[model samples]
Target: MDIEDLHSWPDSVEEAEALQERLRDRVREEPGPAVVRTVAGLDVAYGSHSDEAVAAAVVVLDAATLRVVESAVAVERPSFPYVPGLFAFRELPALLSALRKLRATPDLLVCDGHGRAHFRRFGLACHLGLLTGLPAVGVGKTFLVGEHVEPGRERGSFTDLVHEGEVVGRTLRTQTGVKPVYVSVGHRVDLDTATRHVLALSPSYRLPETTRQSDRLSRAALRERESDPASAPPPAAAPRGR
Candidate 1:
């Protein structure tokens, strides 16, 4: 894997924050197209060695016939460590590469992570959306950043996720009697729109079908690498500002 030389990385937390601001932007809502054609999901996981990570992108049919269409995977060394609010720096390099390899561009991206529910309101999903200039949503299994009252144990129930007294995202009950997933705007999409998309994409599960497929695909790719190290794709060129 070819990772950018970040040995001389940001000297302090303030510097990292400044750099984040320079590369980031606030999330916005988008009026998605009525006719949905394609939807993509992104998920990442560590390799068997735990030294490398495999990021996968999967596009699926969005109409009544939901089926897997295209998929891609990339491997890269983790960057920026595993800090709470800095996962993008560790994962996006590989994730971006996997996304670029996709043959189809979906109307929406369901990211397996957080978005506005972050410190700078630019979580992994938001960062990826801004970096790729695509419409994306953050669907996190765990709350990374945000506060919210629990939604009722019923499908479609929701409550606002607040941070510092400002609305940032939502806790959505995708499935009745199951824990809800956190929904947030990644980029070019509003929280309401994001929630709606998540609901539409979810046919019969707690998480959207696209994201669940991506999560499975990503982990499978990592398993493949474990079974055969020779098949792993090289990481992209060192990203700028690394």
Candidate 2:
């Protein structure tokens, strides 16, 4: 779970955006692992009282059984500002810390955010995949940037999400009669493979099991940090842009 030191932490919005543009070229839009035995879900939960407090969680699950195999959590204050397109800068540090604590190296990473579907096409998933050198997919709860037709009511149905006339992702229906989730290529995963993985992971819920489980764990960790103030880490210095 060692992450590559890709670049220094950006100090401003301009620096972050420039970094994204540079790293976007490194993203490989290819098929992911054919046999995924373990998949890790990544998510972050924020404190209700303080905007700075946050918890990042990584839950590795058995791909076939959909049960957690290993889990880790990191609680820290966000250093980057909350800009719309630069959220990865805010969450990546804590998420990477959590990932480093995991004993099991996941075959695939399912992030609770956008990938190629973002305005810059280098969302959290892409950033994470590049740093970790792991195949990753982005499953967003809401649309970030795209125009797409509504998918069919049946599960597995999907429509192309077009952005700037390019097929960036898919509006996938993971469950029958449920609001579709957005599936985008993170790093080495193609759109089709990403869609199939997402559908398989979400057997009975609108969101994938990876996302659901990680979400719950992140919230629980945040609650733990809130209840015991002494456990909270010192606040990160606010990035210059903020």
Candidate 3:
């Protein structure tokens, strides 16, 4: 699997914003294949309060059956610190590993973070989509960018996520009376199509089945790795000056 260097990890908001704009130019936003048969979800977890991060990915059935197909996991050094507007640097390394290990190419990717919903218009989903050249959608739990009004109580309700006088994403209501998921285009898809895909995958829950299952799988795998003595390596010595 190909793993890019984490040396490009940004250390400041200005650097992060520049990187964000550069990344947007790298993504190709267009109408992708509408007949999606395979879908993937991406998620991450931390070890010992963010010193190290673990990433997990799962591919699943996108049709009415909703069955799992394949999955992968990875571990890497946490290069970027825990910053709100620059999460991509912290998680992208491990996530790239997990994605490379996947058995099949996914038709669509549902990321566990924002896309265009960012202060600089580049989030994990958008970055990954650009790096992989795959169609992706972001479903964030909280607001990282944009201003929007509250959606309706019923299912399938939504409003535009506006920022700087432009509609960048959607505040999607996947299930009735539940908190909405922030939907946005990562690459090779539009906001409307992204919202439709999220709803189609959400048969009985607030989150899409692919995303929820992947989240569970990621957490479970991290816990397993922590508990398994054989899988873990010996700890290194602490830094000399510390």
Give all candidate RMSDs, comma-separated: 4.0, 2.6, 4.6
Give the clash total for candidate 2.
0
lDDT of 1 by residue, 1-242 (tens): 12233323454556666756765544556765445677788888876655555555555556455687777877666655567787776677677677767766777778889988888877888777766667888999888766789999989999999999989899999989888999998888877788888887776999888788888888877777778867765653445544
Candidate 3 per-residue C-alpha lDDT over 216-238 given as tens digits, one digit per residue, 9 for 90 to 100: 88787778877875676223221
Off by over 4 Å in 3: 1-14, 233-242
Best by lDDT: 2
Model 3 RMSD in Å is 4.6
Assess every candidate by TM-score.
0.86, 0.96, 0.87
Error of 2 at 179 (Å): 0.4
Ranking by TM-score: 2, 3, 1
Q: Candidate 2 — which residues are off by over 4 angstroms?
A: 237-242
Model 2: how far is 114 from its true place, Å? 0.5
In order, how many clashes per candidate? Answer: 3, 0, 0
Models ranked on lDDT: 2, 3, 1
